[model samples]
Target: MNDKLTRFLFEDRAVRGEVVQLQGSYQSVLESYHYPKPIAQLLGELMAAASLLTATLKFKGEVSLQIQSEGAVKYAVINGTHDQRLRGVARWDEGLQELPTEFSSLFKKGVLAITLAPKDKERYQGVVALDKDSLAACLENYFLQSEQLLTKVYLATSLDSAPKAAGMLLQIVPPTSETYQGGDNKDFEHLAMFADTTKSNELLELNPEVLIHRLFNEEDIRLFETQDVLFECDCSKARSAQALQNVAKTELLTMIDEDGDIKMDCQFCHQQYVFDAVDIENIHNDNFDAFNSDGRIDERTLKH
Candidate 1:
């Protein structure tokens, strides 16, 4: 099945919606690590949420959803761009015997943060406490607190065999003209009822068209063109080397002396990058001149 996100608007009500189904992209993320069952499922939901949230971006940069806590699962994060490319990672305590299944139990005193980093403008961040039972609820709370918009989010994941994730979102749109009155609680509630009835199996299996038809066959839904979603990591040797440049030279030299080289592993894609003495020296002396005017590393300079 194609992993895609579909957006739609209700002609009769001042509300918009988004639905995303994941198959290949979700599986690609799981293949990178042997995450525990609960953690895998949580990551899947976060990825789905990230995709849905990124679809709302009006700028040309990336957005990230992160959950941090001092619980068994230390942290989980997913990043996505306006184009729908996504990547995620999760970290947890080692040798934990029991993992809580509920969000409150698993993430005691946790915080959920959404960050928007526009390419040309200032970045914006909004944070909320993880006081809800599910990730979807926490996201809804985020909208309520930050945007003050009546929004609803539904997320589901299945890791039985082939991992997959799906999610749907609905938010009331502000009226633009006198003819277009703002959405009321009654209209939002009526739509939310249908959304709340979505089953995990239906979400993971059905296509967006079929899913929307099944749920809102009575409503006037205007479906838009689907957008593809994929598991994409932006990590590269150049980026990794530039990151090394931020380190103290003495610390890097000590690492090189002890290990003969410094190795860096991308937490998102698990790709390993090795920097030998020559690579380190070249990077140190170039003063980042290896980077071209376009901000991309000149690969030819690293060959020496």
Candidate 2:
């Protein structure tokens, strides 16, 4: 399936929905590392969830969905931007030859954190416990606690050699005094009932139009234009250089003395950036061009 996110609205019910399917982007994430089946599956769900939630952003920024746990999986996160770019990674126990199959066992004592960072506005974050068996259920609870908007989420992922993930989100639009007359809780529940009947394979394989029809054939639905979603990592040599600036000049030089160079690897995409003694010197001099001559990453230029 093509990587796309589609938004739709229930004309009379005051409800909004989004459906997202990922194939190429999903493969890009899985190829970055040799993730176990369970980890890959979990990352796939997180990727889909990130795509669905990022669509709600009205400003220019990114959304980060992270899970911190003390179970077999230590940490997992997916980052998505307002324009639908996504990247994700997961960290698991390195010693385990075979990962556990039980969902609860995999993420013991886990907490899910959803953060929205806008470029020109203050950031907001919501935290919730991962007490549910599925990621979808956890997200549903997050919306309930944070926004108090009746919401439902369904996430599904394929475990085959070529991984794919898809998700659907339904939310009740906040009611205003004039618009709240007939758009009651029952209307939202009626549509949610149809959404709950979606099968995993159907969500993973079916196209958006067909899937929407299957679920809400009788409802007055207005499907919006599709938005493209892809796996694009923001890591680059320039950003790596900027990150190094956070370290003291003396410390950076000491690292070069010990190892002959500094290496930075992005966990999300596994791309490596190497900086030698000269590169470190240039970094300390505030010379960004030496490392980012190609202009691969958009780094801020500092005035001397």
Candidate 3:
């Protein structure tokens, strides 16, 4: 599959790696909004990173990578589930003459938040500064601080008519033996050195197997089954109706009176859900106590 992820382990070393390629799913996210070139590129890289990070999860839930800032690009987030399903969205300041190329310029005081949301357990979130030049570098810094493990992340994206993104992650597994002190492993550094040689074009265009072989021809590696990655959004009319519950009943009635119906658009997928007065009445009458459990904002106010 063009959109798939593969996991591999170094048999003789305490290192694990994952490779992810995205094309169809990447295109789907771009199609939902007319994003600027830089924003589109950022989203692609985030998607790849999210996929790689999601594979590291041992639970049945999703991982979200979010960047919040006060600069031109105000907010951006990509959510990826354990099964590789993904979706993303971004918001930026309007009327900007040009978008900045540097990460710091685009996001003043920006912080990257990595959140692990489990299906049945409490969610965990870690934050790191966006001081690095690229997302890959920021992620590496995160691994060093939060995980205390050496990690190498390579992310590449092509914003062509058919957008594509791919990434590789190599990490030193936790020490299991007394000899393996809490630090970088020699074998991991060796493999990471080889992985760093991969060019952006090679990552986006080469097959996963061929790329792996080219990077570590001498290492004994065990490749696992490939998992498909898809662009999926869970926003629905019912969910939109449920979201209306967040608004005050008087406000809902006022909106319906002013427009004859209240319209809600999903920020992620741009899907529009319209609710008439009758729909609003039923929504209030129904017992949807768990409406906000999903934590999805179905109604977004347009900014001038």
Model 1 over residues 264-291: C-alpha lDDT tens digits?
7777877777887777776777555453
The Cα local distance difference test for each model comes to 0.84, 0.87, 0.86
238-283 per-residue lDDT for model 3 (tens digits): 6776667777778888877887778777788887777777776767
- What would you estimate as the lDDT of candidate 3? 0.86
Pairs that collide, model 3: none
Ranking 1 against 3 by lDDT, winner: 3
- In model 1, which regions exceed 4 Å deviation? 176-184, 287-304
Point out the higher-scoring one by TM-score: 2 or 3. Answer: 3
Model 2 clash count equals 0
Q: Which parts of model 3 have CA positions greater than 4 angstroms off?
A: 175-182, 287-304
The TM-score leader among the candidates is: 3
lDDT of 2 by residue, 1-304 (tens): 6899999999999889999999999999999889898999999999999999999887899999999999889999899999999998888998988998766678878999999999868999999999988889999888877877778999999977668999999988876623423234998889988998999999998999899999999999999999999999888888778777777888878887888778777777877788787887888888988766443333222211
